[model samples]
Target: MSKANLSDNKMSATCSLSEELMALLPQTKESFKLDFSEKVEKSVVILLHQARELFYEGKMNECLKTSETIRDYSWEKLNTGTWRDVDKEWRRVYSYGCLLKVLCMCFKTDDIGEAIRVCDMGLLMGASILEDILVKVVNVLQKHLQHGKRPETKIEELSKKKTKSDHTLAPAVKLGTAVPILQCPSLEFFRKNYLVPQKPVILEGIANHWPCMKKWSVDYIQEIAGCRTVPVEVGSKYTDEEWSQRLMTVNEFISKYIMNKNDIGYLAQHQLFDQIPELKQDICIPDYCCLGSGEEDDITINAWFGPAGTISPLHQDPQQNFLAQVLGRKYIQLYSPEESESLYPHETQLLHNTSQVDVENPNLIKFPKFTEASYQSCILNPGQILFIPVKYWHYVRALDISFSVSFWWS
Candidate 1:
């Protein structure tokens, strides 16, 4: 959606949405809340990396400023996208805000208590994170306290309260807020037989139903998408898939993805669609498209072939993502929306924490709060379909050589 549309669009219907979102959010807005999707998680990773780099470079002031900016931007972004958990974002901002505040204090040379106080301000903004940060304050003070600078009595009191409350939740019950549990099948068959429910699975039979299937393939996509000029970080790669879902012009997607695909001179995007006027006709699409009903005018696809370590970080699209596995299996770790606290989402909106955290060996220290995450696992087969709901946080990696098609639909 464009900025113009946001202002001119029928926001009257959505005005109440803003208020509802705010109320759902926890008092704390320091952390992020990545629900049954992946985008927000990726955004958080980027912030963590950026913050670490800045801290290491001794640009603490710059880093702090950027954190504040990201916090505000994330809220605005979520506000614009109706798909996000507005309430969760509210709490998330504060949770992460607390983390940033704590980091800021760690770097302060003057008074540790002052730094804790500064971080504690997030309590007013993101109370959950503030609570955690406040608990840590006395410990930090004790570590750096000079002479009798230690407020031992207050610190002990805080420590006792924290110890009283700290407890690992069940695999199902999430930390922080109490909400209803989402029941999912064991899906053991999909997990064990497949690559531990990792690979993207495409239902070839279903492709027969999609209007675009056989008509769109490597040969055809190459004609429409074209062997184009492109840019990348290290290598350039792309993939395509045809599915049979809606009975219409082009089955579903001419989805073109390229490895390390960069912006400038990306011919695959500029030419392919322009060349395929057949694809431009009144594409009715569907109500659940990732880009929604009308935006098919601006869509593209690519293929991936080269890479052992090639990985798409934890993230998600605003649409209902349909991923089909063609050859290899890719391990996927998905967290539900209810596990928002565990994900520690980003403060900004459009940009998710694309950082792919190793869920298996999560650097718990780096993502200390990640221990709060609760997720469902799955592995896609040659014909399996992974229905990734909007905003769910997913971390994926190829278990081996693999091929797949991700239909980013609403």
Candidate 2:
């Protein structure tokens, strides 16, 4: 159906949409009452109630303005402290603003594609609230388009540019030490040999069968998830004073940071699979994760996508990690937990897991013992997984434009 048909049948579409979307209001109200009542600022609570009333009265513009006010209030609370200090009340309030804003956009706009983009904006920026109601709404809108119940303007095909760099790939670092490499070892062997002793090993061939090895290219990611919003870390590493985070569409992140490479932007440590489930279909959880806890929900998967030269400063994680390289290569160095004293951990609670010493360029005068700490290094290639035992001090740097998934389990 052509988009022009929408004006003729606009009233019918609007009427039917009211019936469908109005059903979600009661659920939204109940969630807000439960989570926000007597908890958040009075102004926020009042605006939320006002937004709901406006929405029910078909005053979408008023509702949108009220929702923006609520969002602004919540964002102030969010920015008062660091990202770690953002509490559930603030996130819920912010999410409600997004929810209300998306609903208003959907109700007022004739363009379904623009409605989807609004939903994506919320999904990219909002925290997990009300069982991810935004995701639910997006699914519903997408179904309407798929069933041809609503006419949609064509989505222009994004430029499928190759991730070629003008700069030459840096030579792989050689540290005179290497983690043991295992080729598709049996689960039994992996558990008894490596998992039991809490040793790190690079496992090859296990991930070779995954579809991501063949299907995931820079273009493929851009095609599938380009429109999606993501939190990107901007700077060479987080430990730098100038380091900061920004939220941008994946397409913008790719063009501005990933491709250009003048400034580094890393989409690091984000649970992207939960946000975009279609991308999750391209890979499977490693069977080895079953060795720990044996429960599916206990596992945490994060996506690390960035340009060459993006660095993860030396840090230790609390859970065991299976770092899988889906595309490009990375140089990873690991130090045992026993060597923590020599590695010079930061004094602050926030950065206690991170080493004060820069592994690549150490200041031997400030921390003379850091040079004496033993470590293992490897150039992790595509279709390979590196097992990092809990509290294993690891430093990572991308050797090329890279996309890696990490599965962390207890």
TM-score of candidate 2 relative to the true fold: 0.82
Per-residue C-alpha lDDT of model 2 across residues 96-139, encoded as one tens digit per residue: 88788878877786555556666665565557766677777765
What does candidate 1's lDDT look like per residue over 50-142, in tens digits?
764565466768777767765666556455646333555454564464555445545544454454444433432343442354334433433
At residue 398, candidate 1 shows an lDDT of 52
Indicate the residue-level lDDT of 36 in model 1: 22
Give candidate 2 misplaced runs (Cα > 4 Å). 1-37, 41-46, 82-85, 110-130, 139-176
Please give the clash total of every predicted structure, in order: 75, 0
Best by TM-score: 2
Model 1: lowest-lDDT 10 consecutive positions: 243-252
Cα lDDT for residue 170, candidate 1:
18
Q: Provide the clash count, candidate 1.
A: 75
C-alpha lDDT of residue 405 in model 1: 52
Question: What's the lDDT for all of these models?
Answer: 0.42, 0.79
